[model samples]
Target: MKFLIVFVALFALALAAPSDKDTVIVEQNSEVLPDGYTANLKLSDGTDIESSGKLEKAGTDEEALEVQGKYTYADPEGKVHTINYRAGVDGFQPQGEDIPVAPVA
Candidate 1:
């Protein structure tokens, strides 16, 4: 019984562990500063992400960090999807082909 339990637990852990064969980083670059930073990443699985963040309204009561980024990935159906987004005081805003548009009244 002890051996069986150990085997099952090990099997479960193996299943939960991340598999490196499915994903790989093809390229990555980053630059960080006191007030801003930028990052770009490309994956072997046809996924790419680029983003930047800056301290906007610095030293103000409403000071906030603004983030702008874009990401592209392939779906299960092999369709490539891209999203452009911004996040900050105005909240997160994203634009993409797969994103549904709000019906204008």
Candidate 2:
């Protein structure tokens, strides 16, 4: 009888534990320009430019970006470009709406 009681208690505890597989994480990145803000500019032919930002989130797959910064991009040829961007919670929903919860036999 004691053994049976212990087994049931352990089973209940296991069920109460949170499942890591059900959790999700999200990340984002952005960049800012030195100037106040700039508009679109044409880049010189055969020139390439790149910029980067950072983001970090946990607890849910959804990411909510309350604000975003402005950034500028300039090509090697000295062509200038500017852009303003913002982000928010996006692409966050359960893969399946009707996941079955099976009873522990």
Candidate 3:
């Protein structure tokens, strides 16, 4: 009877244990552009949901490459947004309306 009770408790614990599982799928691709290279990535949530981005660059200045690219994706609310940018010795600059003008030094 004691062995039966212990076996029942173990079985109950095993049934209550959570299963470790991940169901996200990711796919990626890349290619050489005329002036630079571009890469793409995709992630799927199994419910027709996904996100992606890309990066590319070209031209060199003082051992630095002028990097520029844009990425767009839809949010959970179905609103689409994009980010265009450039980066180099001057640092990362985003394309937007509110340009930060340097105050007269």
Candidate 4:
């Protein structure tokens, strides 16, 4: 019936609609290099994620990215964790608590 078809179409559209509850929410206010940004995402299954990044330079008048600063959130076994990382010509270096990693054999 026509009513049945309309109902099915509406249902399909609702399911396909974009929703933050089911997808990650991005919060960036930068449009150029050497800018900072942060992101907060909530998963459908009740997971909270927070991250941030920014560009840094050794000195002014620098052209390209040299050192990258970053931070991320991790929840391991219901324990909250914070991680900080940096990357450049040297290499990507990460420093944080060992709580995220379990004892390795």
Candidate 5:
């Protein structure tokens, strides 16, 4: 009976463990661009969100850059919405404006 209880407890513990495939890891790195160059973030779902302005150094620091971009995503009803983000020395802050999405050609 003790052996059966131990096996059942181990089975329950194994069931409660998190699988590696269910985790997502994000790595932050700086992307360099030429002058007047703009970057676009293309999502895996075919959403092409463009940057509003060029990225520049937030200050004299070499660690981070200021990113000004808009992110667009589609809802279950097929309605697209845009959320603008700005990254500075204080970190990323999302703007409240939601722009309508344009159809991707």
Candidate 6:
């Protein structure tokens, strides 16, 4: 009785959940090699991302992957934003209009 009612309620809620059918990948491209890789994606939701990584200082003790990429997306407020970034020994550094800047002393 009680258990049956709970099961039915849970089933109903599950059916009401939103589906991701609308958020499809409109375009995608990628390539990989022994030293590096690249990727790009565009989604129906108006999000785009492009990235690539290269082996830097290869065959050396300081060898590392240097990555560079950018992404653009729209916020819930309907405002579109773009960000460019790099990652490597220096760490992930991102630049965008929405990113805050520290006030100079």
Best by TM-score: 1
Which parts of model 4 have CA positions greater than 4 angstroms off? 1-23, 34-64, 99-105
Error of 6 at 12 (Å): 32
lDDT of 1 by residue, 1-105 (tens): 223224333532342234445776778787777676777777777777777778877778977778788888776678999989887789889999899999999
Better of 1 and 5 by TM-score: 1
**Structural similarity to truth (TM-score) of each candidate:** 0.77, 0.25, 0.41, 0.39, 0.42, 0.76
Predicted candidate 2 versus true structure: per-residue lDDT over 42-103, tens digit per residue: 12231122222223352346422223333343334556544443433442122222334467
Residue-by-residue lDDT tens digits, candidate 6, 5-105:
24333533343233454566778787776687777777777777777778878888998778788888776677999988887889889899999978999
User: Against the hidden true structure, what lDDT does model 6 obtain?
Assistant: 0.70
Evaluated at residue 20, the lDDT of candidate 6 is 51
The sequence of per-residue lDDT tens digits that candidate 4 reaches over residues 7-77 is: 33353334334643354433323222335444344433333333344445535555223333333433435
Clashing pairs in 6: none
Candidate 5 lDDT tens digits, 20-95: 3342222222233442234444434434455433435534455344446665655557687776767556666776
- The local distance difference test score of model 3 is 0.42
**Which lDDT values do the candidates have, in the order given?**
0.70, 0.31, 0.42, 0.41, 0.46, 0.70
Backbone clashes in model 3, listed as residue pairs: none
Pick by TM-score: 2 or 4, better one: 4
In model 3, where do residues sit more than 4 Å from their true spots?
1-27, 31-36, 44-61, 96-105
